[model samples]
Target: MDSSSPAQGAARSADLAALDVRITGCRACPRLVAWREEVAATKRAAFADQTYWGRPVPGFGPPDAPLLVVGLAPAAHGGNRTGRMFTGDRSGDVLYAALHDIGLASRGTSVRADDGLELYGVRVTSPVHCAPPANKPTPGERDTCRPWLVRELGLLRPTLRAVVVLGAFGWQAALPALTEAGWAVPRPRPAFAHGARVTLVRRPEPDAPGTGPASAELFGCFHVSQRNTFTGRLTPAMLRQVLATAAESAGLPTRSPWTS
Candidate 1:
């Protein structure tokens, strides 16, 4: 098309290529791979042989986004099937709606990555990349998967103003990384109650490896899983409250951009 178009395309290509490298070669946990593969093979008809991503799903958002949305893990038939965060599922439906209302989503739907959806000023990722059995990941598996999460957050360091954990487990998984980086731990730790905000000032700590004393904030909420969304545990108003708290924690205006 235009001169600048080619350059833009090249930059996008390089970024996606790097994401592919991380996804395809990820072997942080063998059990996760085996379980997902088994699920993929046994449920072949449902997927029409399209194949499962069966790998780590990287976070989706702008590189310099100031906000990070963290989910617990991928959904077996959702992200694992569609190869995108919070896509092809109910959890995604609720999340996207809220995001759109809040002015974070560039689109209303996210059935697939190519669905022309984009996130502005925000990134979405899961602590455990692969879909876990019964949607529950073993502590060992979560531990093994921590390094990638650490690296991803580090890369987004300066711009990562605040993180909104979608569930208790997500908060738990993120705790070690933040602490290791010399960030403050939540007083009572990351519990499942919604709208909790913990802010830590960043400072250099020789004892803390792989993280600077860069201050960060953590927001807690219930997971937007099927159980939570369908059972009314996480209503649109509830999610908005959580988001507002997170934004406020990061010194953003407290008004919600989206309607519940």
Candidate 2:
């Protein structure tokens, strides 16, 4: 099937939903599987009575969103417990707050999956779905998890015009996936910096013929981790500035619908 066909795009949208289900069931890496489950079983004192998701976390937001936000992975007690990316953690507090301030999020906090928070023109995902030990996924684990992201980008390609990578890790992971998904990655690859920006032209694939070529932009921002936020290395203003640039590049309204 030509990947660019409307029928195919619809099928891909359904596949993306199916992929989310599959992501929540993945036990691809023995280490990640063990760690996630072990943490779930040993429940933290504060959340001892709650049942943890204890599985890979899936991407959240509209599939046709123009802005895609990529993070490193789920937090051990955060997403691992709440089952939503950037939910139930301090990092999430900072991220959602910034998103709200910039008019991307409907609310300033995301405590649970059913919190009724909504995103405008944006989606959030991660390079590695499963939370890893010490908050770090090994190179082998990252490579093993690449296919899911590759498939996700393929499904999101039509409307995806800009990407906001949270950190260097996400920046590294997204580059290859974008390339595999048909974006012409520049040689020497763009370096990762807090405010880095790169524009790549999409190339039509023989196997997945699309409507000619399209251009997309990539923006870099420091992760909304407590380590960075608490230390003042990544202020909310800084984060909003990068997102504002991305939103403009994606042809989205700079001011959110709810904002003045």
Candidate 3:
């Protein structure tokens, strides 16, 4: 499919169910395909007996979320193993805990896709769906995976108003996809920094009625990687502050007082 074709956009804009089916079946990048499968086959010691999802991990959470959380890619033994973004990993532990504390997540831990943990007014996704070798995706691989994200943004345009990008990689990758999906990105784009914010107004499109030029804000946060969390580069308070800000900007309900 032509990444920019109207048909592709229509397909992705259908619904999360359709988009998910396409995402998991993707084998567009040879390197990613081999690496994800290789890791699944070899298996991590602790999860040796568990069956790995071994495919592209789809974004998870409410379909009509007002907020979107974008990450770099799946980890070798994390999302790639569990078929859910951020699941089965330290990074997910940090992220979901904050979301839970802030009232966006139903639970503080996401061990598997069926963990009964639901997100309120929020969704989690990544720039690259498949796990890359050494936790890094080549520029070519990133570009190749761009369409899926672009289409996803298009689908979520109606309600999405705030995006929290984790780390510089997700920030860089998100700009083009947002632009392609019709958000008016600024020239010489705003540099990525912790807590940095940029607002982009959606562009009017004939096919996209009732969705003309709605504004969305982007907020930056340090990746919830073990490297950053363990070093105190990104603390629970720091991440929660960013999420609270983004949620407010999206007009999501205030976090429940009972949440902790």
Candidate 4:
């Protein structure tokens, strides 16, 4: 089953919603705080008239998602302006388009938070919520913002069966957060490589029986940044293969992702 009893599902949904609200208000890192706000205030030339989200961007998708996609962070003008992960960004463009091709998304394009795009059985989040000065978050900043990912994994522990981490940065970041959230990380920790798969485990609790799944698989994929996509380092077919595999691993519905 995709979720637990309706009551339990509702409770978790509420908790996830609450968590997202808290994420938006967080200003834990001073550097990140100044950068995000400064960008929002100065504004990009194309978006000069638009109001920026100017704060942390939270995860987006169903509370009972069976799969999670972890990325590095929000784009300076993308999620930072739109207030939605992957929205108004080139990276988001490739990711969502592949998602739609694999039949996991309602639409292939997402321009704004109000664009009505939706994901089925999948959630997208980042280790760092705030956009960094040069699209890179310091190790200190990543560690500081980790509590949010840890909390999100805890809430989704009941239903999340697999994860697809984009880039080495997210892979490294997510492993620790997942471990902190109750999933076991393999000793010597798995390294990131496109299409790599690792299944993390959880010991069944004798005290609390029948909580959630006992194990979850993690998949690695190249970041869908313009650098990767534009250079064909991560082709659309390659992306479709990884996403389709991860979606099926999570027990989500799927059709063949290839279109001749």
Question: What is the per-residue lDDT of model 3 for residues 1-260, given as tens digits with 9 covering 90 to 100?
Answer: 23233236336547887887778878888899999999999999999999999998989988899999999999999999999999999999999998998888989999998889899999999989999998999988888888889888988888999999999999999999999988999999988999999999888878766762279999999999999999999998899999999999998875644423
| Candidate 4 lDDT tens digits, 34-77 | 99999999999999989999998999999999999999999999
Error of 2 at 34 (Å): 0.2
For model 1, how does the per-residue alpha-carbon lDDT over 104-198 read when each residue is reduced to its tens digit? 78766788768899877788887788888899999988876665566566556666678888887888888886665446675666565587777
List candidate 4 stretches off by more than 4 Å: 1-14, 205-207
Query: Which lDDT values do the candidates have, in the order given?
Result: 0.71, 0.85, 0.88, 0.88
**Over the stretch 24-60, how does candidate 2's per-residue lDDT look in tens digits?**
7676688999999999999899999999999889899
What order do you get sorting by TM-score, best first? 3, 4, 2, 1
Number of backbone collisions per candidate: 5, 0, 1, 0
TM-score of 4: 0.93
lDDT of 4 at 158: 88
Off by over 4 Å in 2: 1-14, 207-213, 256-260
Residue 229 error, candidate 2, Å: 0.5
Which candidate leads in TM-score?
A: 3
